[model samples]
Every structure is written in structure tokens, then in C-alpha cells.
Target chain A: MRDPVTTVRPAAWPKTPALKVGPADDACNVLIVGVGGQGVIMVSKVLALLAQSQGFEVKQSEVHGMAKRGGSVFSHVRFGKRVWSPTIPKGDVDILVALEWAEGLRWLPFLKAGSGIFICDTKRIVPPFACLNRKPGAPMRYSKETPAEVVAHVGEAYAIDATDMAEQLGNERAANVVLLGALSTALDFSSTDWERTVAEFVPKKTIPVNLEAFRRGRGWIEDARTSTPAVDVPAPTPATAAPYRIRLDINPAWCKSCDICVKMCPERCLILNAERIAELAAPDKCTGCRLCEWLCPDFAIRVNLDAPEALAR
Target chain B: MYIETAADFDVTDYLRKEMMPHFLCPGCGHGIALRALLWAIHDLGLDRDKLAVVSGIGCAGRLSAYIDANTFHVTHGRPLAYATGLALARPDLHVVVITGDGDCLAIGGNHLIHACRRNLKLTCLMLNNEVYGMTGGQVSPTTSETRLTTTTPLGNQEPHFDACALATAAGAGFVGREVTHHVPKLKELIKAGLEHPGFAFVEVLSDCTEIFGRKNDMGSSSDMMMRQKSEIRPSAYLDTVDTPFRSNALPTGVLTRNDRPEYGAAYRQAASARAGTSS
Candidate 1:
């Protein structure tokens, strides 16, 4: 197995085609669309954070359907000079980053002419209704109108089966990261920015595959840039602020290394010490989502938000 | 020796301290229930400083925002849990919970039943309007069977919950019912509920003129109130008895009033016993 975090090319940001519009022009609006449980909201949040780090005003709103079961989900992410509404009007979206190919078509109405980019994975998830009604499953039919095909037919498109790529990389859910890898080229963001975003958004247990998927996407973008002049976008400056500040801490004395804390750490920051106590592997990577503290069986690993001195020292 | 009438009772004074302006519709049952409770508090002469009101979300949940006393407006259906926590933490305060039927039985029904079973020292008033008035006329758990609502246009199929019966069965020390129009009876029930030593449940059948009236043709407030008095007669057998009965009949007076150690006091006793053993 790959050494999860170490093998990830954190610094491997190969130069791609740069698109620099003057600062006065508004930053383009990108919509990330997917079904519930497919991590569209996480991608939107990371995109929002990424945009903010690049000194752009960002506003985002998520429309979650009946999320417990397989349901249609989408997020409106508007980031530019002055974003008023969190919604992207029809036919105005610049980049549509879809985790699934069918989800890309689900949001096809918002694609603009000439500049619109549809970055998608060829994976298919048949919604429940299509299965129960004996109707032709939306998935089999949807693959034909792939994001790449749609974008190419309308303006520009990049289509890859990110799911197969991530599965080959040994993680299936990292499909979104693989698509994100494809998206980094269109947006002209750095690899460090992608890694930082992944470290913050994707929990620790799945980080390895997610990082690999991102690398795969970034590589695809680099290779594609050689063939076609990449979309005109300026390089995003690295966030100067100590960006990956972690808030959760583990108490070495109390933790029995029960693996519950490690399993529950959404950011995958906690590791086992010699004495079987859960310890922080990447203290800076903790986003303080606090899923670990809520699910801890032993109450060992604490979200040390209450004591500033203990955490700061 | 002097006898004074209720005319001297400043009902608004019993408002659980610094009350806030709220979103209750004019002449809403919740407003009447609040007035009756205040009158009861004044009649019982309870200390204002020792009062704690816990409410859940709904139109009634707005009670927390208004009261001057320590008030907790917890999540819908979770006020009892928060109230349980508060009652345990501060046993000295008179913990009173004001909740709507939908807020209590439908969402918070589990907590309400458990609180009664545990016999915690708290007074719970369930304001039943037969529909979820705040969120539109949705059919609520306490909504009467065959009643029309926004969600149940053809009429509600689900049988309404008898809060008093549920509480009595759950071992609450006191359980009673009264309509909002019967302010005197409502005040009496509220007083008894508050004075009870353990968990007390009082159901106040109220009017939802905007929803129930609009749908069921219950008529104007006065006509509806008059109907409430005429239609709702206290169970005859209960009128004669001084003590409460265990049967789940619709009686006017106190249904069940029995002495039982509250959950918090029992928990503290157990904790102290362990401490004593260790020492």
C-alpha cells in the first residue's frame, strides 16, 4: 500500500497554461453539482475557501434534497469581484465541476457559450426512482451525453472516468478529487492549494486516495495543456497565512488507542502512539469539524477549543 | 381574616420575569394559557426569583424569549431534556415547562413521556390547538381524529393524543385538563400542577382561529369559546372524588396526584450514597 500522506506530490505543481484577465474584471462563477452523499458540498466549501484565499469575494448556497437516501443535490457557488446572490443564473456558469457525469447533465442549463467548461467523471449512479419504475436507468443513458461531450458541443470540455482512475489508485470516493484534479487546470490553481483544500475537506482515513486522485487530475491537466492552450486564468497566489490550523487535540494519558478516535477523526489527523494513545499526525491539518469528539467511545481525544494556553503551548 | 376576589390578581405579574415581545397571534390560546399560568402563579404566591420557564419551538416556544426569569428555548421536542438538565442542576428553582401539543407530543413526545415517568419536579403545560398553527395548519399529534388541516384536507386519520392520560399512565404526580376559555378552571389546574411535588402535566385545550376556525367553521372567538364550555363537560364521576383516579377518562378536576421522589433528587441521593460508601 502507498504510504498514505508521504507519497502525495504536495509540491508537484507543474506549470499549465495561464489565463490572466485584468484585476478589474470579475472572477468567473463556477458551480459544483452532484447528488447527495457524493461530496458536492465539500467541494463547494473548498472552492469558496480557495477563492477567499485568492482575495476574491465568495458567496455560496447549497440546495440539498432528501439527503438520507440517494437524492439530487447541488450547490450554487458564486465567487467574483462582487457576488450578490449565492445562485448562478441560467446560462451564466463558467465552470461546471461535476463529480458524476449524469450530475453534469443535470446542471447543463446553466452552461454559458464559448467560455463554459464541463469537468466531469464518467461514473454513473442510478437514482432510486429510475430503478423502481422499470424505466430505463438514467445512468446508462446519461453516459452518452458526457460532460466532455456536452462542453465540447457547447464550448470547451474535459471528460475522464475519474471513478475508474481513483479506483485504480485504490479509493473509489476519491473520484471527486480526480475531477478536482482536472478542474485545477481550468482554474489555474496550485497543487499546494489543492492538497491544502483536500487535507482540510477530506477526512484522514480517505486522504491518501484523495491526494492521489488530485495528483492524477493535475497530471491530466498538465498533459492536456501541452496539446491545447489552457483556459486563460491567472496563477492563484499561495495563502500566506498559516492556513491549515488544526483545533482538535488528543490527551495522551487518557486515550487507550481504541482506534475509535482514529476512525472518527474526519480529517484523519489522529494516530496511535506506543502506549496506545491517539496522537495527532498532522496537527495543522485538523479543520475542527469535531466529528471525532462527538463519536469518541472513550471521550479521550478532545476538541481543545476551551483552553487556548494548552493548545497554543 | 379577609377574603379577596381574583379581581386583585395581577395575572401579567406572573409572567416568568422580564417577558419579551413575541409573535403570538392576537387572542391566541397560548396567550390565554400564559395569562392563566400567571394568575395561578400569583394566586400560589411563588417567588419570582425562584422561577424557571423552559419552552420548546413553536408559537409557544416564543414564551422563552419574553420571560424575565431564566428561560430556555430549546430545540423542538427537546425542551423536556433541557428542562430535565436545568431542574437537576438547580433544584431550588421552580422549573415550569410551557409547550404546544405538536412541540411536545409529536416531536418531543418521547421526552415528555419520559419526564413524567421519571417524576421530575417540574410543571409541564401542553397547549393543544389540534393543529400546528405556527407552521400552517398541519395535522399535529394532538389534532382530533377526522379534523381538517392543511396537511389533512380530507380530515386527519391519526387519532389525537390524550396528554393527561399519557402522563397519568407514565406515573406523573399530577395530571389535569382545562380549556383556554375556562380561565378559572385553567388557573386552578395550573396552580395544582405547579404545587405538585413531582412531574405534573396539564393540558389546555385551546383555539386556533386562523387554522382550526378557518377550516372547521368553529366560528368567531366568542362563538368557539361558548362551544368549548357547552361541549366540554368534566367527567361526572371525577367531580365527586377528592383524590385522583388511575383510569384514563376525561375528568375535569385533578386526574392523578401522588407523591413520588423526583428523578433529580433520586439521582442526587444515589450519588451521595456512593460518595458516602467511598468515604
Candidate 2:
């Protein structure tokens, strides 16, 4: 299998001819698919709101199966002069926004052949259950197919590293907005309308960062249209990485003893101390993936990239 | 105490008049549960100022909005935890929690068990409609075997939870069960629960007519009520059987009672003893 984290910039963008701005009588069906907590619902809400602003009747139907546990979730959004049903018929979806690579493949049957625009984020979330029966010392099971395979199957597909782009913009949770930015390029909507819809839908505090992420997504697509390949930086390796130790600082006054960060840390580097504030428990094991920092709702924990011990390392 | 006859029970004093008409469906049993709760408070003549109602998110949770008391509509499945804190901090106030089957038995099950074990002075009324009514009738923990729900398009294969048995096992000071069809009996159970000194748990078997009822072909609201009337058995009769709840006969009435030391009073006594103060 190909490297899962490798950025798969679309070789060419705007593959389809410019969409004809048909009258309100012509309806459009958009399908969004992702695992729970990836903000698939938020993207659909923005689309519905933008459709409504354009004086179109919008109907959105969402299937939330065991949400909050990384279960499969999808939404059907139909917008037109008159929306009769909340669900879009099979093989009638015009635009498909998949927040996960495999999920995009899962909904390939729903997309309109030759005409559908498939926008996917090249982030592979390996299903936990997929590894239940694996043998010890076996390779970790992930999506064997590449984004190129997905593009070939869908006929007209754009694969972008939305998660990496959002992380570059300071917050990884803004990946949905990045995909929305890429989606905005395929549609015949103005940037002003997309910005207004995003500002109205996203929280007030996250408006600035999310807007920047959105613009970066649009810019990526615009650059791809000119055959500009996305920057191909080699994946970070522990040896070649910045010779710095991961340092975590916890603001005790800000922490409410939630312990979310401690529980979410994949490296088991954090633990709640006697005072219930998060403290670095196993600093040597710290990989500095920033999962704890991103998952911390209180923003009480800060992971400093460069420590003074870097010179010694 | 002034209410002499059923017809004379004035519920307007207990309700938020501005919030009416309530948003319940035509035959929803939540209204019945709310009425019984109001009647219990009315009969006890408890000061409304000292009464606080806490609820999680569901159709039953909406009971907080309609009641003209200190009501807290908290997040889904955490009402019991919230009520535990309220009961401990302000021992003078009576904290009653209203929750649905999905809220109490599924997401909030851990809190429910812990609260029962703590034996805090709180009344928790669990309205079990066997389906999640607010979210369009998804299969809940209390949904009976072979029942139809939106999620369980086919019949539910899982065995249902016996909430009363669960509470009794969890060490609640008081445990009662009643159906919405028996309003007078339900009111009595609610009143008894309110008067109990420690963690009082009352499970009211209600119906979701629009969702569960319609899906199961259990005709209209009145039809479902008739089914409830026939299915329920007295607590005294239920005790004789080895498997009391193995069949369709649901036991209704106070199943257990004890004099466990309430958490708030016990904590205060322990703290005072540590400080060399007389209790």
C-alpha cells in the first residue's frame, strides 16, 4: 500500500467544464461521507445554508449511526427551486464531499457517472474492528487502495491533503473547512458567499482560523488548476527530525481537571497529577503528535516544539 | 392538600403558563408523567421554592421547561450526576431528576448506578417509553425484544433492561415502578419517592404513540394505554415468581425500601466529627 500520509494533490483540477448556472428549476444533490467527529454534518449545514441563501429550497438528511464512537456517518443534501424529499435517490448525487478516503470509495455508487465531482480528503482512519482478528507482529491494517485508485473509480475526483493543510493553519479540526474550500472551487458560487456562510455557521472564536483554512483550500485548488503540484515534503522521521525534545506545559489555573488530554494522549506521556492538573508523566515517550493539544477543549495544555535540550540531543 | 377530587386538581399553579401549549404529540405519555409529578408535589404541599427539577435531553427532559420550579435542562444522560452535586451542596433543597429510558439506561447508566450506590437524597423519575421519541424512535436500551424502531428496522434482537431490578440491585434506598395508564397509582409512587430520605428511583412505563406505537401497529394512544393496563401486575404478586420479569407481566408498585444513611447528611456528620463538632 502507498504511504497513507503522503499528500495526493490532484494532477489537474477543474477537470469538468465550467458548470452551467442553470435556473432554480434544476436541482443539485450533494452527498457527504465521513466517520463521526470529522465534522461532516458541519459541512452539509454550510452547504444547505448557502443553498438557502441563493433562494433554493434545501433539504438535508443525515444518518448518524453510533456517532461519537468513530462510526460511519453520511448526509444527503438536495437543493433546488422545490425539494420534494430530504433523501437523494441512488446514482443521482451530483457532488460528493468525502472527509475520509475509504468513505469516498464506499459512496462511489451514489455519484452520477461522468458528471459527478468527487472531492476527498486523503486521511485514512483505520477502523478499530478491522484489526481485531489480526495476528501478532502483523502489519497494521489500513486502506490498501490509494487516492489515485479512488480518482480512477469516480472518473472525476480531486484528492487533497486537507488534514495537513488545516494543521499548517494552526488547527487540525478545521480540515472540514479546507475540504469545503476545495468544494467551493468546483461550484459556481462566489468566495464572499462561502465566507459569509462559514462565518455564520462556525463558532465566533474559530471564524478567523477557519476562514484562513478555507482560503488556503481554495488557493490549493486554483494552483492545481495551473498544473502546479502540491509541495512534496518528505515525511518526518525521528532521526532526521528537529533535534528537540517535546515539551508540554500545563496551565493549572485554566485546567478544570477534565483529564481529557491525559486520556487522549496516544503516547501515554500525560497524566493527572495530585492536584488533578495534567502533568508530563512519561516525557521520554512523548512523540509530540499534538493529539492531546488538539483534543483539549479548555486549551489548558500547550506543547512546545523546541526545548533547550535540543542542542544536547 | 386542597385538591379533594381528581377534577379539582389545578395544574396551572405548577406549570409555566406562558410555555403552554406544551409541545408533546397528541397521545404522548410524557404529559401524563408530568401531570402525575405535579400532582405528587401538589399533594405533598412541598414548597415550590425549595424544589428543583433536573432533566437530560429527551421528550421527558422537556418536563423541566414546562414546570414553574427551579428546573435545570442539562446535557443528555448527565442529569443524575448534576442532581447529585445539587443535592450535596444544598441539602435543604429537594432535587428531582426526570429522564428517559435512553438517557437513564444507555448513556447515563453509569451515573445512575453511582448515584444509587451513594444513596444521595434525590428523586429520579425515569420515564421509559421503550424508544427514543425525540430523535424519531431509535431503538433504546429498554426496547423490548422483537420491537420495531427506526434503527432496528428488523425486530430488536437484544433483551430489554429491567430498570426496577437494576435500581434495587444498585442499592437505591427506594425503588418503585408504575405505568402512565394508572395516574392515581403513579402519583402515589411519585409522592412516596419524594418523601423517601435517600436515593428514591421511580420507573414509569410510558408510551411513544407517534413513533413506537405507530411502528408496532399498536393502535392509537388509548389502545397503547389499554395494553399497559393489561400488561402490568401488582408488586406483591410479582414477588412469588422465581423469574418475576421473564414474561410480559410488568410489576407496578414500590418494589423495595430501606433506611440507608443519605450521602449529604452522612458527609456532614463525618466532616463535623473530624472537626470535633457535635452533630
In the order shown, what is each candidate's alpha-carbon RMSD?
A: 25.6, 22.9
For residue B157, model 1's alpha carbon misses the true position, in angstroms, by: 1.5
lDDT of 2 by residue, B91-131 (tens): 88989999999999999999999999999999999999999
Q: Return the TM-score for each candidate structure.
A: 0.44, 0.45
Each candidate's DockQ = 0.01, 0.01
Candidate 2, residue B148: lDDT: 93
lDDT of each: 0.70, 0.80
**Which segments of candidate 2 are over 4 A away from where they belong?**
A1-313, B1-8, B238-248, B277-279
> Which lDDT value does model 2 have at A274?
97
Q: Compared with the true structure, what per-residue lDDT tens digits does model 1 show for residues A1-313?
A: 1122221211211132243433422446778887778788888888888878876688988887645676778887776666667787788787888876677787877877555766766666766554332211112223344333354465556666777788898877778788877777666567798788888888888887788889898787566545652332222223334332445555454444445456545567777777766777876566555545433322334453433455468
List, residue by residue over A1-313, the lDDT tens digit for candidate 2.
Answer: 2212112222222233343455432567889999999999999999999978877678999988546589889999887666777897788778889998778878988887766778888877778876552322234455666666566566566788999999998899999999999888767568999999999988899999999999998988777656735433232222334444566767676565545466556666788899877898887677665555543433455566664466467
lDDT of prediction 1: 0.70
Give Cα distance to truth, residue A145, candidate 2, Å: 98
TM-score per candidate for chain A alone? 0.60, 0.65
For residue B199, model 2's alpha carbon misses the true position, in angstroms, by 0.7
